[model samples]
Target: GESVGLHLPTLSVQEGDNSIINCAYSNSASDYFIWYKQESGKGPQFIIDIRSNMDKRQGQRVTVLLNKTVKHLSLQIAATQPGDSAVYFCAENMRGAGSYQLTFGKGTKLSVIP
Candidate 1:
């Protein structure tokens, strides 16, 4: 398990193939998790999300898995597309004192080759 706050900054996948992106979080107290995709010069867009209580969650063509044991998180794309090329980020929603804040990882750039 690794963090967007750590590890390599890029990942490359072939178009039409499945892609698996990984993220490692630092806060064990984090209860909520989200995946964001950011294209060049654009804001990060929500891709998917999972709660600490859930081990897995699925979306249209994406899936998110959480391993609380090792504090690891991953995103699985069913069909990697050129449009999917972007910087992927993992963020955590931490709560304390009756309030919550967001913490984001570095980001992994996904390059889709046709």
Candidate 2:
């Protein structure tokens, strides 16, 4: 069995500060990794993706770093904002024999103290 958990249920930060969201993944054999941002009542939006072959990837205002040795992952946001307050989840894609499925972490809630 595999699972993901957040170290904290909620994080409060100032509007101009940077934010780091952490996730713990259970399955090390997973090939693809994705970070998603979910706004209230909305579907998760793709933030960035990285393959097992790569250690890090970056996108507009966001960066994702993966550490395979420790089975850990993290998301970095450049500037915190009120709009950036939301729940973020990490998903791992398990690929085998042409089959794939995404397993999502529980998620961490970000709260901006604007």
Candidate 3:
């Protein structure tokens, strides 16, 4: 149930503004979270990550906030740009039964209008 599919394929944004992308995760036991950015027709690249033990994690131009109590996560982009336009995916990793696997939430499309 953690698998994600976008309702829209594209999002247009102005070049110099902040962007917030949303994703919904299914597993309540997931302990690790990661955010990835994927450009048009490209593989997803790691943006940032947060563990269940922490509530927030930040990167150079990005920040990931996790609310384990509600099973919610969010990614914030400082400045929007044409190069920043891409699809964003949130993934969760659950550790149990002596094994771990990543479950990806449906992605949101981000488009920056330059």
Candidate 4:
């Protein structure tokens, strides 16, 4: 079963350094995953995502890794910047024919230190 606040925390990084964010999900049946970045008072912005069929996926300056064995996922950011400081979140969605909803994990707030 998917619920809320599985483990949303915070992550801090220095400017120009690489950052790694992690998430653990409860639904093994979930096949779709997405990562989002939410700044203060702003809507969430899509970062990256991965499917159950793939173990790893990458985007511009970002990487997503999935470990179904442990039901864990991780996000890697290359050269973290001050603008990257925000609350990072992970969302999981199950595969179905009908309508489906997203189960968002606890957000990790990344504080970029200059």
Range of the 10 consecutive residues with the lowest summed lDDT in candidate 1 = 1-10
The candidate that wins on TM-score is: 1
Q: What are the per-residue Cα lDDT tens digits for candidate 2 across 45-76? A: 88899898998888888989999999889999
Task: Rank the candidate models, highest lDDT first.
Answer: 1, 4, 2, 3
TM-score of each: 0.90, 0.89, 0.87, 0.88
Better of 1 and 2 by lDDT: 1
Q: After superposition, which runs of candidate 1 have C-alpha atoms over 4 Å from their true positions?
A: 1-8
Lowest lDDT block of 10, candidate 2: 1-10
- Mind giving the per-residue lDDT tens digits that candidate 4 earns over 1-114? 222233547677889999999999989999999999988778789998899999999899999999999999999999999999888889999656786988887689888999
| Runs off by more than 4 Å, candidate 3 | 1-10
- The model with the greatest lDDT is 1
| Full-model lDDT for every candidate | 0.89, 0.86, 0.82, 0.88
In candidate 4, which residue pairs clash?
A: 8-106
1-110 per-residue lDDT for model 3 (tens digits): 12234475556779998988866678888889999887766788999999989988889888888887778998889888788877788999977799888888668888
Q: Candidate 3: minimum summed lDDT over ten consecutive residues — where?
A: 1-10
Per-prediction tally of clashes = 3, 0, 3, 1
Candidate 3 accuracy as lDDT = 0.82
